[model samples]
Target chain A: MKTLIKNAVCLIILLTAVIVNGSGQEYVKLERSRNLQLNNTSAGQEISINVTDEYNYLRIKVEGQFTMGSLLIELIDPSGNISRNFTIEAGGVNTSDIRADRAGAVSGQMQKAFRNPAEGYWQVRITPRKATGSLRIYSLQIYNPRTDLIELEQIEKDTDEHIG
Target chain B: MNISVRAPISKKSIAALVPFLLVSVSTSLAQHKITVDIETDTTIWAPVAYLSLIPDFNYLNTISYNHIIEQSGISKEGLYEFSTEYLPEEEHLYRVHFSKKGDPPASLILGGRDHNHFFLFAERNSNISVTVKSGNRFINDLIFQGYSPNKALQGINTMLEALDSIDQNGNIVNREYAIEAIYEDIKTYADTCSFPLPSLYALYNINYAKDYDNNPAFYRRYLHKWRSQKSLYFREFRSSIRGEIKPSWLIVIIAGSVMLSIILTMYLYSRLKKKNNKNPLSELTIQERKVFNLLKQGKSNKEIAEECSVSVSTIKSHVNSIYSKLDVRSRRDILDIEY
Candidate 1:
């Protein structure tokens, strides 16, 4: 019985060590959305959005003068691939949601996500229609369904511990 | 009849006597004397007229006129109509005057006398037309000669003085011509006078050194004495100018400093890296430490083998195991590790 308890204590210590090391690996937080202003007068103004280690869902919102031109958003990955294409026409100053995984395989598409590609480097391209006007984007949100479930479970556990 | 004849004869005789007496009385004559007186007048000759020659400047003197007489010669009154053939072929100035007293000391007047064949000498050429007249009559052509060098120099000096006066009064219309004349005078003086080259060089150097900064080589070549003591002269020249630095020396100093800094930085970096790589975890094991300590204190591997009572291969195996456990790849790695 003593040997069993000792073995159990050792196993617990090893598991604790493994857990501590595993959790020690850093986790990064990304802002849910960002606003970008693209005035058509200037060219090569790059807007980079990071989508690594997060759920693939993306939502873009735009508000500006709309004409016959189109707004183009390209999803890029680690291998320099255009994994998805999102197009919105004039008067389409609204939110558009997409899942990057379901997008078809194409040349120059990002294959797998990266942990840290580079600081401020883009995994996506957001290009507005070239016209004589200013474009104001209100928000871009990357939503993960798994993050909601995890937050819900945490809240439940905290409530149970508090009641007990 | 006889008586009548006697009376007639007597009467005839008486009548004849009367006729004879009348013939004798008829021979009478008359004589008268005639006398005549005559008067005459003579003209006295006057002196010949002459024109006096005057020099432009004092360096020249007037000379006598050698007049050539024509076929008529000079008139008794010394006044005659001059013919073209009586004019002198060569031109000159003559101090000619009229003289009725036959020669030199007679009273002189401005009357021009021309000869047909004599040459006259004068100081300068005449520009005015000389029409010799006693009252309103014209004379022959007059000739004039030019001044000699001495006289020319005097004339030129007077002209220069006049030019100077004009310049002071601000009346120089053609300044370039005046400058050219001045330069020609300087060149003439320089060519005629013997001046030392060194002195001339120094004078010009002082005059132009400030504005001659662009062509140092030209000055240097012409003024070789200045370059004879090159170092001293260069030092003086450098001090005269502002902020003169030798580019070659600056380049050497900068390159040397940069190379030295790079080498020193690399040396320090390599030393720190060597110190960091010498950890016991990377170079030593526990068994290796024990064996090394025993070997350091003079224990043989065979004695170790005998004490452990193992074969030599087993001892070798233990040694190999010690080497592997020490995490050392070479003996040098072990030796290089600090205690």
Candidate 2:
């Protein structure tokens, strides 16, 4: 049978080049990353994260300058409840997508993903439902996934150029 | 005439269906009473209390509980009622809140930080009560005795928490003109609040899509003075805040006043075509209009060829044909034409 159909087309091109080089060598196990500078005052601010059972995911990424106010950004869990919240206003960002920067203030990012998330402490409050601003935590990170999957848009462009 | 039926009833018709299901559950627990005293500290809040109705006021920060409707629990002297005989007999907007019972299945208890929910108006023969005092701040020491638009919605949430504590104590040195003069005293207390559902909950706590484009005639005189008050939150504030108050700076000021009146009508039609080409010498040649009236009488193209009998090289060819038909440059701009 003609060399077994040329060794089955050379073993299907070496198993499609080892599944496209193992999905272009994806990786993520970061576990924690910071870059904080927070001060969204007016009696508001809380950020704790201890989430153990080996991280699953959690991002934060704010950036602000402020021309007015309104902040919010919850997350809670580990049983204090709210597992996701965002606001960041001056008349914008109530459910993500803000991007303005170049000194025009706003920048957003809020994330949560975990099938097993609840492992002890995990807070991230930051509240200021209007007036009191400047919260540039460019990255909070905490990662997990391994067998190929690390995309929150390439870790938000390598944690905003490794903290701009 | 298909009339088939099946029979299994007999124990004296199931003992006559338990007193008609306890008289329809005690006439639906006597049609509504929403109690709630709430002190709950099951190690930091949650003996359970939910409620929800919120079909408007943009679902007040809905993180999901797809409008809950009911949940009770509390009782070891913390009270808690809410069955609200299937709500909806007009005045709606309810929401009660309190979480922490290991929330995972539909969580959201929003009201910003530890303010975990309050809102109320209620109906379906409301009896309401709501005390919630234990360590204060449950929406700032909640009180409300039997709904009168929840005490003018707790005095418009304590004048919007004193206008967010005067924009968090930077005490307004023109914080956008003192937040539009405290949103015109909260739209004059939602135009004299005597309950049109707490003046639509004090104009949805004065954020109404960021001050409805800075005063859309006070939201069109609050939708024509509450257009004969019907509800679902004033028909979703008359169909979603009435045509989004045309904002983008009023379309960049009506496209910058139609591009400055189309650039001032092409600069007043090019100054009325340069004042109709500043004397077109009536489109010329009556020997260039007698050599442009003897070169506007200052003469000299050999005295305008001895007063227009022509040839001083034909009056310099009628002064270069009246300087190329009045777009003049000399004869001192053709004797400064006023025609």
- Best candidate per TM-score, number? 2
Cα lDDT of model 1 by residue, A86-156, tens digit: 34333221212211331211111111122112223344465655533344332222323333434433433
Residue-level lDDT for A28 in candidate 1: 26
B68-146 per-residue lDDT for model 2 (tens digits): 5577777767688876666877778787776554432224433223445677888787888888566774556678897
- Per-chain TM-score of chain B, candidate 2? 0.32
Number of backbone-clashing residue pairs for each candidate, in the order shown: 14, 1
Candidate number achieving the greatest DockQ relative to the actual structure: 2
- Error (Å) of candidate 2 at residue B180 is 41
List the global CA lDDT of all models: 0.37, 0.63
Return the TM-score for chain B, candidate 1.
0.20
List per-candidate RMSD values in Å.
Answer: 61.3, 21.8
Candidate 1 Cα misplacement greater than 4 A, ranges = A6-14, A17-22, A26-34, A38-44, A48-69, A75-81, A90-112, A115-124, A130-164, B1-339
Question: What CAPRI class is candidate 2?
Answer: incorrect
Report residue B138 deviation for candidate 1 (angstroms): 99
Model 2 regions more than 4 Å off: A1-71, A74-83, A86-113, A116-164, B1-32, B35-79, B82-89, B98-247, B250-267, B270-278, B282-339
